[model samples]
Target: MSTTPQSPAPTGMYTPGDSSAWSQRYADAVMNTFGAPQRVLVRGEGARVWDDEGRQYTDLLAGIAVNCLGHAHPAVVDAVTGQLSTLGHVSNLFTTPAQVELAETLIALVYPGLSAAESRVFLANSGTEANETAFKIARRHGGADRPRVLALENSFHGRTMGALALTHKAAYREPFEPLPGGGEFVPADADTLRAAMGEDVAALIVEPIQGEAGVRPLPEGLLATAREITREAGALLIVDEVQTGMGRCGAWMAHHLLAPGIIPDVVTLAKGLGGGVPIGAVVATGQAAHLLGPGQHGTTFGGNPVCAAAALAVIRTLRDEHLPERAAALGRRWSEQLAALPGVSEVRGSGLLLGVALEEAVGHAAEVRDELMDRGFIVNAPRPDTLRLAPPLILSDADADAFSQVLGEVLTSRTTREARA
Candidate 1:
């Protein structure tokens, strides 16, 4: 290997072949929040990654719905590198051209009916920050009269205190009790939401598709019901599109496709927004747009030029390449194909985001996930029986077919062995 650009000081050692050493080093330094690293991935190109041992795997998870355009896409590379080199960061006090452009672009996509002047954007570093900002916006909009913020059950927002309060999962919340207060979960049903939403409510947040709930798309008209209920109750309707936005579900924003003609007061974004460069946004419209005002909220590195540029590139690439349409086409075809497999009983979700429900005979999804990993495929098991697939928008048909074929073999063998046992 050629090594010419050595650091003037000393660079940390990186072993290309010794993953165990790197894993130990990581455990020694990094926090154990995510349990353990799945693989010591060194580099990636388009929908594939390589470990320290140079073993390759098709990356179907796409960094948990963040890498929309896939790894090292030229547009994102050019925009991020160019912006970083020239004008990387200026404090929130000083806005860059890229920041302004990205905000407008997001508004256009999130609220196409509303003019840029009618909407406002608060940029942040991740999906969690975006949800945190949305939480604050709900409080500001509701004022003292309305302190109740309602989210749907089985929802997963960011892990921060405020976002966690809005998240419904007990395991993710009970450990960190006393979370800001007033955030609660309502059953994800129109009847329950209608009954729960009242004059005292501050806001109701809903994900068009509850991603952490294993890519489960909300029942049709759910967002519409939310919009109407919240509107009647004088509460803001916040759509947490962190995992479903930026062309993940074959649409720029899943809400647009799932619930057309209904407008949300606040929409939180991240994940694919920066195509893996780490950026998020809270886009608010109408009355919600002016709630924060000055000094109410701020961030140090939010909307830095580099991330903004990266987001703009992702958005532009999506539109220019018609990737959302492609995702729609491929998602439908792949879902049908996967559903026909002997192991899969049902398939859920849209665009590239999918959840395959394994039959009971096929064994747990985690066990199957490990089997697939061993066969050079990287996927996610969000639930015990559901395998979530959020592959890159640019994923090739060949990889999709290979994954399906391998999954079928794994499922059949597991089923046969289980039947025998």
Candidate 2:
């Protein structure tokens, strides 16, 4: 019997000892904007990724909460590929069915009770672009008299000129001098938010759950207070959902977690919306919805067919698979497990957007992160003592349990090593 020659069992995509070479090449070719790359990832499948050195890792960060459906999700892949093959970019002068359908879907999810005409969407390419668009809407809605835009202290909006102005990090904002608008910073407390909502305020932007500042959640009733104050001041309440929306917080939008019958004028969204494809949107309602009229703002590749198709697919999958509810249940279980770990002081954030505050005695958060990475777990240290985990929404139960067990083991090992030392 003639047997087909067996292909060599694939060791890895890259040859052995190639990681250092790849890192050197990356340093030479790429800009140093993001410091150094942690690892030269060679492949990703579901919640697992392999580096150039052939080391495997369970992806807990999920590209900073952008991979809602996980890496190489078939739905996103097929949708993007099919849409690209059918029709790609067609400029703003033209409209594609995918773009229109995606917009309609977002409006339906974000404002369920409202009619199509009651809401409007402005598509962009990234979180920064989405925030930038919202900034423009705020400026237009407020007019020249109201130039001040209020943002909460420790809030993270985006890095663009306008969005950076709304972002409250001095280290990030101070370097970029004279941002687009008169940016005002205030605490997230109700009293501070109210005091900052003066007549000159164009908009008061706040994240539903602050991501960069250790995933801190806003106090209950503060959003309602913001709504009332902004309304009294004739200012817009812009909720920066870039990190908290698109099922990251077990809801289509984190605002849904608030008390009944609360709505913001503008909501900015990006990460996880397109299931890894680059896309962002600014959804507006009421008078603010119509603020951006003709000849005001535009983008060249904002609503390209492929990205829209990817977003539509992600939305469909989130609904059909009930990933948001899954994320809620998984988040609760994972948070409890993490809280039980040796070095974890507390667990913050909702759903998959979570942060594990490490005990100060556990040494540096960066050290813990490196140890976890060495043990095949990927997480982020947003602060010196906070380990952030924004894992994929579709992370399986087995994977979740495995990650918890591994994290516990890593912590135990560290403790043992410290005692030995």
Candidate 3:
């Protein structure tokens, strides 16, 4: 496939004139959790998207790092469409070739040294579901008497009750109080994590790179120490790679870069796994793989054939195209350019997953993000001083240069205006 960038379509599939009608329909039919739609995206191809106003924007966020292959890639479309036409779904009562193959692929990717039989997979429909399943498996592994779980601060696991309890944010957890019993927060330090673990603790769940926390990569040696402490305490170390897996962090798994021998007992994945279609997986190693048994956990839509096919396609595409290596090279170049820009205090993260921090808290990261959108770029502001960029792994040097130029302009202009004021 040619990597040549494509121009944005002359017109969008939707129009701004229809915004009110669409907004009304969304308000009446959809839930209010996400508040208002940013812009009614009409269509997309590769790294570009068109909004309701027919304005085009380079998709730097990649649908929150879900569109690994970019919008409507031929591989994803063909896999999903072909699978849907052939066999859409068959519940857990039966298994399909794609489902089993996807499980094997994930196991190989997550635990390269482990055998397929040694690592079992339980597929779900989203990242939260994957974490939810891992939580249940941990609880079961420690038996009914042991239910406690230790989670790191500034961590985000998921929103479901089980996953929510493990999530560290108070605001997101407090509203849905009395979540599952036995989940505690510890500082991301190894000592704090060791201090929190006990015999009754079932697991220590953590993100190798905390995506929602402005892409904060865990400090060196912390993950290795956490693994040792969890094993000593007989607690499972669960790595939530939901946002960091599938070559997003320049490796098949971000933890691989930190600690080579640091394999977690349980690994949860989602986000870019299926390129865009929803697919979540929990891969368990050693005895943890068999803890769930026959009837301990299951999902209605989990491991549906169509979703599995999509995941297989994504995995194959990553390997065939050697995207992980590409991501590593591009990430280094992009981070260096970003750090060279004026007012850019630091650039942290691996692969294309990066957080650019400014010298001063420009209370307007969001405002600047909006401006970037207006200027035909898409980025995200996870915090007042931090801007995250998780573009598609397939993005080319030209795309990286374009993003750097626009980002430099945005930062320089903002800094200059603030100085004037």
Per-model C-alpha lDDT, please?
Answer: 0.90, 0.87, 0.87
lDDT string for model 2 (1-421, tens) is 2232233224454564542466665676789989999988878899999887778999999999999999999999999999888898999999999999988888888877877797999999999999999889988977889989998989888888888988887889898898775888888788877766789989989888888999888889888898899999999999888889998898889888764477888988998998889999999999999989899999999998999999999999999999999999999998998899997899999999998888766777889899889989999999998989999999988988888888788777777787788
Deviation from truth (RMSD, Å), model 3: 5.6
Summed over model 1, clashes come to 0
Q: Is candidate 1 or candidate 3 better by TM-score?
A: 1
Q: List, residue by residue over 232-312, the lDDT tens digit for candidate 1.
A: 999999999999988889888898899988889999999999999999999999988998878989999998999999999
Arrange candidates, best TM-score first: 1, 2, 3
**Judged by TM-score relative to the true structure, which candidate is superior, 1 or 2?**
1
Candidate 1 vs. true structure, TM-score: 0.96
Could you tell me every candidate's TM-score relative to the true structure?
0.96, 0.94, 0.94
- In model 3, the clashing pairs are none
lDDT of 2 at 126: 93
Question: Model 2, residue 280: what's the lDDT?
Answer: 97
